[model samples]
Target chain A: MNKYDKCVQYILNNQNHFYRIAYCYVKNEHDAQDVVQNTIIKALENINSLRSIGAIRTWFYRILVNESVNFINRNMKEIPYEQQSIFDTEYTTGFYQPDDELMQLVLSLPNDMRTIIILHVYEQLTLKECAAIARIPQSTAKTRYYAALRQLRTGMEDCNERK
Target chain B: MNENKDINFDKSRDAYNNMAIPSTLDDKVKEAINMSAGKKHTNNRIIITVASAAAAIVVLFIVSVNTSTAFAATLSDIPVIGNIVKVVTGRSFSEKNDNVTINVDIPQINVDSTSAPDTAHVTAEQVNAVIQKTVDDYMQEQQSVIDDYKKSFLETGGTIDEWNQRTIDLAARYEVKYQDDRYLSLYLYMYMSAFAFTQDNYYYNYDFVTGRELTLKDILGDDYINIANQSIIEQITEQVNSDSNAMYWGYHPAGYSGTDPFEDTDKFTTITDDTSFYLNADGNPVICFPKYSIAPGYMGVREFVIKRS
Candidate 1:
């Protein structure tokens, strides 16, 4: 099969995880669908540009990250500081159905930390791979991952205190 | 402490993986692939190149197609600062000899990856390609509309010179209002003055993690439509009654005989999806209705800022 066909097969097999990664950014069903669809289109078009077949996973994810960033930057707007805590409300109000308290802590992270943690811990990617997707240095990715851990620890402590 | 941290990490990892991926997504992907394959003409078509400067130091682009064109002037091999990424602003401007003008600016990503360098450039190139394609498609459609107008003008007995004398211009620019590791909001404003003055506004809000363009319903949840509609209606009524300049079509002086201000609420309710809104500097959603929708055409556009506590 051609590169496009190969890319399609890869996407089809890994679509569930792809959708989850997308869902983490968009937090909605339809928009996640749009992102995944658009990312696939983008990935197929640029498949020829890939330098190595071994790096396809990172390359595909880098596209996904870029698309997600573009989508958010394209749609960025202002919310009042008071209303900015909507993500918290989204989780607590049943808008975001986190499986448990740990999931809620994962969601509570600011976008940057949350992304790094998800990539390292959840996606099981190495710091090098996370850095590639994040378009940051490996050192920075390492820092962010550890920082996210600390934040989650603090969050868990606060939750337990409240109980 | 490290062991506890490791356990927490494992727990979070499992939680992350366990979240359900919609079963319909694979079907959607297959359908999208098929659909894209069907559209041969526009698929991966390099449409237009908006701008390219031959300067060695600064390379500026407003693109149509051709990824190679964007890289004409690349950033220095030496990465700038610690995490310095160059933001390549893609812009396209077309002014037909007849005074019909179209200007478009799209932000393109260019990163200098001093570390993990191989794929960063690749990702940047891909992003530039995708964004350029989107802008090109939008401009192509806009150009088609202008072409049709000129054709119809000739058929309707309007001389070429007369249409030329009309001096119609269209300008659209995309603004990156907010950017961070995970979120991006872009606002597009297009104004066209062909027959009468008209302007359109679009907001593309995205969550980078989810890779989705957010909408009002997504941000505000299910009850957003009713809540936002009521809030906007009340705000409009207050403004119309108190502020002399604020006037909806219902409150026009020429035919002020009898029209309830709430007469437009039914129409307002119709704005359930595809509602045009932008976030203010304070990050509040400000809903913008097109010209003549809620007010007189001359008033241009009407906007209501939704303040949520």
Candidate 2:
């Protein structure tokens, strides 16, 4: 099959993965879906720019991450006083909150470190591939992965002590 | 090393797997693919036509150069047309490892001065020297920051592995914003990302005709400050009204309580002589405020185009 067909198939197979990854950033159902939709459109439109089929997964993830970050940046401006209170309460009531303690700890990490953990541990991408997706150097990704794991270990110990 | 084995991600992985997939996702993917397929064909046709036209131009130019000595002489005489300045990466330095990443691209601006020599004030050599020195100084400052971060990280009971994992990135790059035979506008940005990201931007605007730096006054005349302030306030008010997420200092939304401490003191007032600005393609002055200057950092850079009245 042609590259376009192959790209379509890849997107079809990985749509759920894309949605979950985007959700990690936007923290809402609608915004996550928007990020995924935009990513799909961008990927399809720039498919010819994809130099090699072997690198499609990282290439697609790079677009998804950028779209997710851009969506967050655009919507990060100030809310009106009343609306800001409601926005705060929505988080307190746990909208899109992860159920598991480990997942919560993973999500609590800084944006860069959390992205590395999710891509490496959850998505099972190699540190190299994660670096490519996040557009960081390989060594940086490896370091971030370890640091995330260290944070998680510390978090788990604290949870155990509290229990 | 054994941390990976100690924590079981099975539950989190299960939660990820169990997350509900949107019901409309399949339809969305199929629709996008179909749309792309249609666009690809039209794009390919346009590319072909443009390529053929370019090819024709190349053939005509080659034939003229080979057959006509006068045409060749004219081409040699006029190396570049108008006030076009060429910017090239003069030097690049990159070092990447587990600890840090540094990538700096020093730009060299070459001005093609085919215009009248009498109108020139600042020579191209002076401009190039100033830019080179500014970039060199910025690189040194950033290098010191990285070194300080490394020192602090190591001193704070951080392991070598952890230190290595938190690789800092330092970069310096330049972009040409607007250019013409009369005026050239560009900026050099220095970025360092360690525990957090910080960027510094330096803007340079030169008027080749006057041979002096271009300023808001030069573009907007004697009443430059008032003109810029009025234009900026109107744009900000319009932006805040249109977008729910758009916010600026001093301007309150409908439900705002007028209680923000920064409302009175840190708000954007009139533009000073030192306000950052660059010319747009249409020659309008675009006043700029860096992140956290007028609005929150998330707003990135706030820019307002001051139309000539």
Candidate 3:
């Protein structure tokens, strides 16, 4: 198959990963679907720019990350200070329980740190690959990953103590 | 507690794997793939790039597929049946620097006047002029916004490297929502993003028979407002009741406190005479609400397809 066909097959095979990652960022069904759709269209349109087939994973992930961030930036709104505090405290106290405590903590990290954790830990990408996708230095990606792990540990400890 | 044991990375992985994948995901993916395949690459493309020494104006024009003779020939080859309206990309402007990227595609509408007499009140020239002006004005506004953002980024302690690392994108494109022999509908959207992001959608509907713009009253008759209002309210209530994430401004789930301290008045009550709408493929009127208009921004743009009984 040509590069376009291969890229399409690759996307088809890994669509679930795309949806899950987008959902992690957007936290909603419709927006996640939109992100995935946009990513596919973008990837196919620029398929010729792919330097090597071996770099497809990192390249595709980079586009996906960019699209997700763009979606968030476009939809970002300022909440009232009172409601902001409520949301922050709710994250730490485990009020919104879509999943387990660890996943909740994972979701609550700041955007960059959360992206690092998802790409490195859940997606099983190397820290180097994560850095490439996020356009950060490898050292920065490592720093963010360790920092995220520390936060998760501290959060889990706080939950245990509360229980 | 052991760090590895406490984190329960396996459980988190399981949760990630077990996240509910929308049932329509497969179909959506196929649709997107097919759409990509169907998209035609712009021919006779020209890119005129102007590089500025300082942070000054950089003009780049990408003219694509503007040959009217070829277009006319293609239209003539196809046997004439009824009035035909074709929307094509007339010109495109694209500029990419370290700090910003702007891509805008200006659409031109072509009416096959040879096949059908110009009986409609609105001419193709008028519609095209309106579209061109709207797009031009929006692009200029966004370009200035980006320029100001770049200025402030440098004025602050932000270094060139930091500014280069961050990039703003502005894009405007059009989509033909629905078209038939008698009616045509187009949707145009402009999206601008830097630190703050904004998207605006514009819709145009035309009737070839009357040669005029299509209004809600024209489609639904005199009772257009009532018909649209009833359909939208019913849809909103059903969505809010069925999905926990679906939230409208004036409605909430059962037994839920609908108080929002940000605004005192209920936001959405009924459709107005100027409410935005487009025709669906089935020629049904689909009412549109801009993001943050009726509900939160996360809802994006809400649409309700009005079914005529």
Model number with the top DockQ: 3
Q: DockQ, in order, for the candidates?
A: 0.17, 0.19, 0.24
lDDT of 2 by residue, A25-56 (tens): 77777678778878887897787567677999
Better of 1 and 2 by lDDT: 2
Judged by TM-score, which candidate is best? 3
Q: What is the alpha-carbon RMSD of candidate 1 to the true structure? A: 28.3
Q: Please give each candidate's TM-score.
A: 0.41, 0.48, 0.51
User: What ranking emerges by lDDT with the best candidate at the front?
Assistant: 3, 2, 1
The residue pairs in collision within model 2 are A143-B165, B83-B181
Q: What is the TM-score, restricted to chain A, for candidate 1? A: 0.87
Tens digits of per-residue lDDT for model 2, B1-309:
575898899999888777777676655554454445445534434433533343344344334334444433343354343444566787789988666788988777665466423112133444566567666665676677677877887899877787776657788898878887567788777777665455666677765444445778888999888888999999998887777446566675565432333455558998886677888889898888865556633455688998997
**TM-score rank order:** 3, 2, 1
Model 3 docking grade: acceptable
- Looking at model 2 chain A, which ten-residue stretch has the lowest summed lDDT? A78-87
| lDDT per residue as tens, model 1, B269-288 | 44556466766666667787
